[model samples]
Target: MRTQVVIVGAGPSGLLLGQLLHKAGVDAVILERQSPDYVLGRIRAGVLEQVTLDVLAQAGVDQRMNKEGLVHTGFDLLFKGERHRIDLSGLTGGQKVMVYGQTEVTRDLMDARQAAGLTTIYEADDVQIHDFDSDHPSVSYSKNGKTQTISCDFIAGCDGFHGVCRASVPRKSIQEFEKVYPFGWLGVLSDTPPVHEELIYANSPRGFALCSQRSLTRSRYYLQVPLTDKVEQWSDDAFWGELRNRLDPEARENLVTGTSIEKSIAPLRSFVTEPMRFGTLFLAGDAAHIVPPTGAKGLNLAATDVKYLSDALIEACVEKSHAGIDHYSTRCLARIWRAERFSWWFTSLMHRFPDQGEIGQKFQEAELDYLIHSEAGSRTVAENYVGLPLNFGE
Candidate 1:
């Protein structure tokens, strides 16, 4: 197989990159290790920053999102038994986040790609990249026990953190920066209606708990716990009890409990790789970096990466200049670092570290109190939450 570009993952980054390139009249092939059903069924981040929504709108993928997505003007910070709302829209001049699952976004992108007759190979195996230093880069893979090689002018490594594309690059040329949190999130999806209208980040003596909803009948919640904690050990009653104690202390009545639909654990970590491009291969999304889920920037950052990468590819292919491709790394890094810092800051602010002594806990509590009570602090949170201003210039 031959194409202008070979995308090495069917996740949001690779799929969106392929779609953007196709919209610009660039032919690209996408290969995925997972089946189409699995890719579409994966559950992940849900919050969409205003900048991300803009990109989706431009790509003509916002029609369903605008209709089905839930919009939030602010979120509540529950501390000291009081609720403080950060006015995201008011502080950011009408900017707000939309609650849309990553799965839905992937489904929409896949539908659009298929409707456009884009080539996507699912259940692909043994994918390998070769000759990234040359003008022509190729990907070798197996499907249905049959091996095949795809030759392309360039390769976009959107295969994610554990992907082979990143490993294909020389180790000496890579610099890794990472921080693993001491805790992980115990997430649950239930068929219960949300207790509150807006998302809530509640701090309690037990730990940090987040209250969010997926739809009218489906609600999602998370509890911060030790990374080694086992989900099987947590009974349904215990989970509901923890949520009620952490999130609803004020209610005189018992908080309602619903049947648990999905329960899983997610580790908290901050990771980033410097210079997202190497030779003819450019990395986007989780393939390049990962953020702690506190800031809800994972999917948003991937979308941002593809936006720049697709534009660079277009310039390189159309103008016959290497400038765009040459600067792809530097360009993507600026935005990536911004999100990295934001995610780190948010994670530190919300999570309780066991290593932090009494003084650290006091400081965290004081900071949370200030963020809820102080106008300036609330504004700072609002600006970051709504969306950072868009900067296309690398």
Candidate 2:
């Protein structure tokens, strides 16, 4: 097979990038290690930044998301028995986030890809990228016990952190920076009505909790837990019992509990790699960086990476200019680091670190107090939460 670019991973980043390229008259192929059903079944973050919504629109896959996704203008922060609303749209000049599940976004993208008749190889095993740093690059994989290869001008590593694309890189050529938080989020999905109209992020003496929704009828909630806790350690009753103790009165009174449809614990971490490109190969999304989910920047960061990478590829393929492609890593990293800082700061402020003593607890309270009372501090939270302009300081 021959293509302009070969994308590893059929997740949103890879599919979004392929959609953008196909619309621009560029030929690309997507390879995924999982089945299509498996890919669509994974439940992930729902909060979509304004910039991410724009990218979905640009890819011609925003119709369903816009029609069905919930629009959140602001979110509430509960601290010290008080509820404070951070007006996101008011602070960001009419900007807001879309509360749509990540699974739904991927489904929409998959529909658009099929409608466009784009090429995607699912359940591809033993996938490998060959000679991405050389003049000619190619990808090889096994489908139904048969091996096939794709010859391409460039390779995109949208396969995520553990995916082959990043692992294929020479260890000596990559520099990694990482910070692993000591706590994890124990999340539950239920069919009950949400506790509030918009998301609620609560900080209490017990720990941190978040109440969000996939829709008016479907709710998603999270509570910070120790790293050592397992799913079996907490039953549905225990989960609700613990969540209620951490919420303020206003939020706690309205909360409804039900049997959980899904339950999982996710560890918090911030990870990034220097120079997202190696010769003809480029990394986007989790393949390149990761952020704590407190700020809802994980998928948005991927969207920005795809935006920069897709534009650069189009310029290189159509205009025959290598400038954008050459600078892809630098441009994407500039934005990635900003997101990292915000997510790190927000996570630090909201979560209770095991090492944080009484002094640290006081600092957390003071920061939240200032953020609630000061317009500038509130606006900073609002701006980052709704997301910064996609091309800022570029």
Candidate 3:
């Protein structure tokens, strides 16, 4: 009936925030609109920044990740039948990304929450938040044909873009910035050895493609498709055929084709909402911002959002200090905006926009050319890809 915090949506961000609060002796409950199985079934990007892995450890869920997640020190960028390696750790001073799937992170957090005897309300329908503008806020939902209300000191709106939390806010106070890419990524997950030791981003006359992996034995590959394209149009053979066409001969030769375990088309987009907080309700992850996956920032951005939010909540509840909570939005937006810029820039550089025309195509090529030849440009890309350090408050 009551808790210090009621988190909407039991996805990684919500569950992660709950884990941090629980560890700090804070009372929090997670409410989900779907079952755990449904949550884990969704496939997402898995480029883990150094900070994200550290956050998982703080939540007591990184033991498996540290052991099993693939560490990528660098990745290759291909254009005009040539591959240029960007040394991430060398450019970022020993920082690297881990190739642990987002599903794995969520599972770890879920397991920790269950082991800790934390309350998680799954399959709760029509979840709603109230009084977030006031000191005492509450979340209510229907379950088993009965209504339940949770009184809480604060609310976390981790329920994603279509989620009710952000949509529930009054539109008059919120400002939005968005760009829907003219293309989408048609990706396939397979149980074959990865085409390469590290991820590859390629730009060819055919289009843009990415070769990524979930682990040593599981590969994830993507090819840019028109917004009008359908997954049904792409069988495993067709997808693999299109993907190989976009890679250099060396990469193409090493590519392994197989039955697709999962396939989907995800539209690329960049979006941000001003002031991630509305009174006592704090928005985190897709609930507040979204980034194109070219920069591999979706989950890492969410990790920082929740990190700032959890730190604020812990400071407010444990230390009886409101400074962090009061400055939550200001702190989060600074970093969120930087990430949005990086994703947009990287997407513009790597993807072929239908509207960009021939001149635009040449410019994209020129930019990649410079990145490959110039140490400064390569370092810039490396720093962003590996993630910027977390710095907040003056």
Task: Give each model a TM-score.
Answer: 0.96, 0.99, 0.98
The total of clashing pairs for model 2 equals: 0
For 1-394, candidate 1 gives per-residue lDDT tens digits of 8899999999988888988898888999999999999997777888999888988877778889999899999998876666778888887788899998888889899999999998999989889999998877799999888999999988999999999988888889898899998999999888887767778887766788888877766778899989889999788888988887776565214245677888999998889887788889899999889998887889988888888888899888877788878887887788778878878987787777888776776787899987877878888888877667657343
| TM-score, cand. 1 vs. native | 0.96
Per-residue lDDT of 15-92 in model 3, one digit per residue for the tens? 999999998999999999999999999999989999898888888899999899999999999987899999999988
Q: Cα lDDT of model 2 overall?
A: 0.93
Worst 10 residues of 2 by lDDT: 385-394
Extract clashing residue pairs from model 2. Answer: none
RMSD of 3: 1.0
Please state the error at residue 70 of candidate 3 in Å: 0.4
User: Candidate 2, residues 190-256: lDDT per residue as tens digits?
Assistant: 9999999999898877899999999999999999999999999989999999999988887778999
RMSD of each: 1.6, 0.8, 1.0
Winner of 1 and 2 under TM-score: 2
